[model samples]
Target: MYWEDFLHVTAAAVENTVSSKRVDQFKEALGFHGIPAGHVPPTFVRTFSFGDIKGLTWPDAGMIHAEQEYDYYRPLVPEETLFCSQRIDKVVRKTGRSGEMAFIYLTQTGKDSAEQTVFISRRVLVWKAAGQRSEGVPE
Candidate 1:
């Protein structure tokens, strides 16, 4: 249901980190004001790095049903650094109700170009099975 990298990418590369103009484009896309007066929205940041992805599939299909939870290293995160993240790691399988599930965890670390960790992000992915056919809590 979620891409693990989202956690990492979200925390790492926010709108300001990307571009203010792009942020507006992102806001338009997300139905937001693109204003920085408030907290930086994670969803917009994720979208900036990785375009619109309705779902995850093969090649990146490893993250199906993830249980892992990630957090930004608060101490390192407040610095505000550039971020880059990828699929990183994953675990895939089939479940009784969900059919196929993979748990993928992504790690992202931001640096100040001096190669120091300015921020860190970890994310989990819960890949929904193909042919699920319906949108309800799998029984």
Candidate 2:
């Protein structure tokens, strides 16, 4: 996708409160044996999920999680109501031996009740044959 188009592709803001009990359950489900540390796991952001943007939908099957990175400015504590804002950061198209693919880079920022950024997550989603456009085709 063009840079201009990518700039406009983004998900609406999503918000949720961080529940301590949910964190405990998540740790147990993953076989993490330990007492509560009060600091949420980097992946805890997954507990608050959101769907695709109106016109940007991932394939129901065959989509791949290409990469992920998380930067924590401060620890996320339990019982704190947090807000998650998501957006499409970048888009790149490449062709490999397998086939054509597009890498959709997405970012989610977790903020405290005060609207301070606590953490930022960058993830790339790879979709096969999703970026190709035939001649005379219009997006």
* TM-score, one value per model: 0.46, 0.81
- Pairs that collide, model 1: 1-126, 4-123, 4-124, 64-102, 64-127, 65-101, 65-102
Best by lDDT: 2
lDDT of 2 by residue, 64-91 (tens): 8988999999887888887777777777
Maximum-TM-score candidate: 2
Tell how far residue 38 is off in model 2, in angstroms. 2.6
Whole-model alpha-carbon lDDT for candidate 1: 0.44
Task: Give the Cα error of residue 44 in candidate 2, in Å.
Answer: 0.9
> Could you give candidate 1's per-residue lDDT for residues 1-139 as a string of tens digits?
4334332233323222545555556667777764554344454435435222224333443234343333444332222445443444544344657466645555544444455544444566565653343342221
Candidate 2: residue 122 lDDT (0-100): 89
